[model samples]
Target chain A: MKNAYLNFAQMITGIMVAVLLFIHIAVQKLGVILSFLGFKISDPLAFNSMMERARQGLWAGIYICLLAFGLFHALNGLRNILLETGLSPAKMRTLTWLIIIFGLIFFALGTYVPLVLLTT
Target chain B: MADNRPRENSLGIAGWVWAGNYTLERYLYLLHRVTGLGLILFGIFHLTATTIFRVQGEAVWNATMEFLNNPVFMVGEFLVVTAFAFHALNGLRLILQELGFTLGKPVPPIYPFKDAIRRKRLWTLVTLAAVMVLVVFFFIDFAAGGPG
Candidate 1:
């Protein structure tokens, strides 16, 4: 992708990450308060509750989305950092491709957790 | 005659910590990078750990959770939460500035010059202050609402 497109993607994915992370953390940590507020699950950290959340298709989908967005934004940011450290053009290009591959692997592994439970 | 030898005064990675002349904005830039790097590392570890936990099944997951249920981990989690608050708020401010929302219209340089940087400086401070407040709130929530 062009630098501009990558930057735009960074901004958009960043926004999504902030929103999703807020939901994920808030729901996980504040499960008791949320449950009192009629969220149903009182202990989100409990193994059963964690599995329950993962099993929900909507939550699983959101988890996958978060994984993808977080990985892309972070790896792109990593690429930018690496480029700024002053590499040769060829080195920078190679590094960028490396990061892309690394990000894809991480995303696959990250999503597998949620997908595993969701399938079964 | 322009003598263009390789500049000897390059600050390098040290510049990320200390440049001779740096304003709050510069320091904020440094903080942004530091927190971003830290968060990225934390995120990767988090994802990897969860993936492993999922693979190992509930017994291992609960055992790992039990192991991590400690004061040190709690403190570390608080720091991560604080870092996230700062990074997210600062990132939003940066996005707005990039989009020209936090900036003023361009004006020709007069005897007394002014531009978007002034407004942006204030926006940075405001954003930093907001991060502080948000972090405090998160702390309270974390303290009051333990692993639930």
Candidate 2:
């Protein structure tokens, strides 16, 4: 049952990451592509401008959703890799909990900064 | 020999690479694992850096960006792009396989193991080619000092 749940989570998160990452990269590159075409999009490298854009409704939502999916996908993928190393069942359980805690901490940090930046 | 049994001593790093006969499929699996690990590491650094921008203010964020402008860091960024290309493309392939989009329907258990590459070789090649193109594009863009 645990293995089944893990596989299901991996499949779902993997799909989410694949789709969201493409969108994220495309948006990042769109700034450059527009500049090359002489349309004068906002400077992609300008941190302030980027943050300002992130504060907007659509970009902010995209960023937050990306963060949520990315954190879960990455940490879960890492945990799967570690499990392949043939740890004892007890060790596996401990590792699972450790990764879960680590994911929560980092997810909190990741989500907090984006929300704060978006609001303020 | 298509063996499903897990090898007891195949848990080591060298074992992972050397234990199995080298094949395109094995190489793809290895590359996927390595690139996934690389992306995870880079993601950690990125998250921390972005969080620093919020917590430490503009001056520190600018300083961090300046520090990242070093040539060595630029090379690292290139590698990160390469990893991203492979990881993302192969991840798409994996997701497709999981959802039963590409691999053909199940067959009788005469052999009990079907080669995925044989079943979806076209997709494997297409994803690999796509990754190569993207990695080359990113490399050129980075070399030209474009925003990553």
Candidate 3:
């Protein structure tokens, strides 16, 4: 089975998340440098509101990528953990089905919410 | 000297507790759940908040932000951040583990702390450093009004 390969994919997805986090940190640092130069930036909400505008574009993409990989990765990981703990094969199959169903629901919501906002 | 050992803490609760061999997989599994659940909750909140903004408009977004920024909520925010750190870093470790290499087999009395202390220390230090950078950036971006 290609079950093992699934893990490889998850790892790749994780690396992507790390890169996105780095970008977020970099942007924050840039903001700090600007303020240090005598900008009258004091209100955090104002800061965040401005950040959100830029972040909305950035995070929208990041979250979508995470959702794509994490849904499968997490569900599969959960299944493997359960199987390792000695669940019967028949039971494991049923459990996997349930996880898949729930995962799809969450996945749909995740995709829908972001697309809705970006579109509107 | 007779081998009448002092029960060796065996055939009792202690024995039951220490019955099975330990595996690297178990620790990886636990860490995965910890990270997965953290990320899942973060995802839910992020999505729900956005959906609310779509349905209820700016008023709801303001309310949600206000609640999140409250003193009590600030503590929860810290927890969320910590959870994300654990999830993101540990997830990376789990990924490395999945590279088809058996970290050797399970060892009895899986003293992960004693055995993996150096590796753990390395990972912890990296995680801490990452957190520091994140905090510095957050301060500049959010506190110093650099977001704009």
Candidate 4:
């Protein structure tokens, strides 16, 4: 059961990573187009305003979801890597728990981060 | 370079220096580490800039904008974007492996232990194609003078 849960988590993380890659590529290409059109959107005011609206958009929500998936995925991956090393089972279990806790904390921070930035 | 003879067959500690083993798992692991570090560096820069913008107001923000507009900074942005793209794509591969999403294994298979990892190479090719497309776009942006 534990193994199954771990596998499921890993898979979800993998899929999210794949999708996020595509989004990143598409966004950068869009940036190139915007730049070519002489629409310099890097200044704080313009960039912030644009991102603010995007942040409130459905896509932004999707990004936040990816952030959560990525945080957990990386943490879990790290845990697995360590486990494959020479660590003892008890230590591995403890480390795994710690990693999970850290993942949760980071996930919370990820969501709070953009909102906090947008606000203050 | 006379005494720098290559070690035959035996992979010493430094063998993993440029990504130790060439195994699938090792490749993914190294890529993950590279991307993770890249993103973390960018994240720090991002948050630090935001903090400065909040505290120091427009003067600092304007200076930052000027600095970021420099060609060197623009190149750095290109690298960061590439790092992000690679990390995200490779991350998906790791997720698929972890999930046991083999090619032919249907959910609740009669023969559960069938080797479903058949199209592994195909998935890798797809990822490579995606990365190549991004690199092309990145070059175009860099050539046309990238973001500030």
| Cα TM-score per model | 0.89, 0.86, 0.62, 0.63
lDDT of 2 at A62: 74
List candidate 1 stretches off by more than 4 Å.
A31-41, B1-9, B105-115
- Candidate-wise lDDT, in order: 0.80, 0.76, 0.58, 0.61
CAPRI-style class, candidate 1: acceptable
Locate the minimum summed-lDDT window of 10 residues in model 1 chain B: B1-10
- Residues B1-148 of candidate 3: C-alpha lDDT, one tens digit per residue: 5532123333443442345773544554455576676766666676576554544556665677666666565555445555555567666655554553425445575554446444344554565577667555454444443432
Clashing pairs in 3: none
Evaluate residue A5 in candidate 2 and report its C-alpha lDDT on the 0 to 100 scale.
Answer: 90
lDDT sort, best first: 1, 2, 4, 3
Which lDDT value does model 3 have at A53?
Answer: 50
User: Each candidate's DockQ score against the native complex?
Assistant: 0.43, 0.46, 0.22, 0.16
Residues A18-86, candidate 2: write the lDDT tens digits: 777777665554445546767565555467777777688787677677777888888888877776677
Off by over 4 Å in 3: A21-59, B1-32, B53-55, B93-148
**How does chain B score by TM in each prediction?**
0.84, 0.80, 0.50, 0.70
> What would the TM-score be for candidate 1 when compared with the true structure?
0.89
Q: Identify the candidate with maximal DockQ.
A: 2
Candidate 3, residue A90: Cα displacement in angstroms equals 2.7
Error of 4 at B140 (Å): 1.3
Q: Please, what are the lDDT tens digits per residue for candidate 1 over residues A45-86?
A: 778878888789999988899899889888888887776776
How well does candidate 2 match the true structure in TM-score terms?
A: 0.86
Ranking by TM-score: 1, 2, 4, 3
lDDT of 4 by residue, B58-120 (tens): 466667766767768777877877787677666666555555663533556465443344346
